[model samples]
Target: MADGDKTIEISMDRARLDLDYCYDFIAASYWSAGRTRGEFDRSVEMSFPVGAYCEGRQVGFARVVSDQIAIAYVADVFVDPDYRRMGIAAKMIDALHSHPELKRVKRWLLATADMQPLYRLHGYADLDDMMMMRLDEDARNRDPLR
Candidate 1:
């Protein structure tokens, strides 16, 4: 096999997740900063996770919150700082797209501030004329754990 082909592997196995690495990365991210461990654990538990591994160590991660039908929301995608520029993120997205359960999803959604270019390459388009709305619930303010 070519060195490029052997460089990384992507898997949908939740057992292979490195929670500490994942949580730490998400906690430091712009979107999920200040996220608690319990929150991370719960989120991961509720989603179908994908991990990209290099030499048996997880180097990237992503998850899909799907109803296994019409919609699937891609969330918490990240490639370790050390692993950026390695095409790992694109591969991870490809794996998610090719996932058996997600294959039939009519719509896939994700929110990204700076990775629009990357996502655009995968057929995600800007919601230029459409209104994207959300209910802003402050979970930290409502959760007793805070």
Candidate 2:
């Protein structure tokens, strides 16, 4: 159940496990991933996914890949802009923090460009020794076609 005037109910249950609605929401939110529904569908088909709904419509989501003993990486978290500031993002994070399978993991990691304070509420922190790196995609694309 959700709090206050918010009409949505937050849940941690697996999404269709296919990125369909997930990426639709992602593309809608970020204008990135000129995605086809098929791509999202295939991606989540094999992963553990969670989603939120408002009036039975998906509004928020988060997912984790975990091993019951050691670690979990939380990824692809989002809530629609119209739903922002309504505590939806925090609720989604809380659901992940409280997940049963995730509890056994010794540690959890997540990557985000912003929203630090929101995540911090669930005890998330940045590790000093870990500097992040990413392959430059444009450079990768410049390689001669195979």
Candidate 3:
């Protein structure tokens, strides 16, 4: 954790997990996806999540939804606006891709509106037959906390 340069830390350690800071960072930086604190908390609770830090601050994050067998989806990746282009998210993803828990996964998937080049560097490509769909907001709103 230097002035502008930073190192990433990985933790399943509950004491080291900054759930509040992570929630705030995602809420402020990502609006198009309209993510909320509860969604962030639930994802971490249910999946393999990694949070990226810059100068001891939560800045970027992503998670893997996998059985560590056939499929792994990389989701909810975002970096703070002030720290963009510093390669923090790339490093975070690289760490996860190389993680031992993820070694068994044969297929990695991600949905990105941009950043295709970054993913391609790690051997991800366009899936021709795959189509993605989501439930309506009203349907999603059925859950009191989403």
Candidate 4:
């Protein structure tokens, strides 16, 4: 599909991913500050990656970590600053939701600091009744190899 004079394509093909752009964007994000390129690459390798391209240049991205049946975690969703406000992010999310492999997922989860409104528009609601917990970073830091 074309957005204005730019042709936009959202695809599931990992080969189309621009790793440098993705890693740079994610590493600068508030949630993933200090994330290494190796870590980002590993995560992309393990997930269902979606790339949004405008005029053959990657302008947006998202990844879904899923078991292909029960649940999926959407992560690292972003649109290049120059491409914002043009509905690219929403289109990427729509592509993910329509993916056949994720059609049977019973649950979808994502954590966003300030994008609740956007997610809510996509049918995600705050899990107000559920307790969300995380292992302390100290526990992770204590691991010898980590």
Q: Comparing 1 and 3 by TM-score, which wins?
A: 1
How displaced is residue 142 in candidate 3, in Å? 42
Superposed on all Cα atoms, the candidates' RMSDs to the truth, in angstroms, are 9.9, 11.3, 10.3, 9.9
| Candidate 2 TM-score, C-alpha based | 0.70
lDDT of each: 0.79, 0.63, 0.65, 0.79
User: Candidate 2 on 65-125: residue-level lDDT in tens?
Assistant: 6664456677678887777878888777767666655555556777776766776666776
lDDT of 3 by residue, 17-40 (tens): 678866776676633258767777
Better of 1 and 2 by TM-score: 1
Candidate 2: clashing residue pairs, number: 1
Candidate 3: count the clashes: 0
Per-residue C-alpha lDDT of model 4 across residues 46-76, encoded as one tens digit per residue:
9989999987789999998988565678899
Residue 30's lDDT in candidate 3: 35
| Model 1 misplaced regions, further than 4 Å | 1-6, 128-146
- Name the candidate that leads on TM-score: 4
Name the regions of candidate 2 deviating beyond 4 angstroms.
1-5, 15-19, 28-39, 128-146
Measured with C-alpha atoms, the lDDT of residue 33 in candidate 4 is: 80
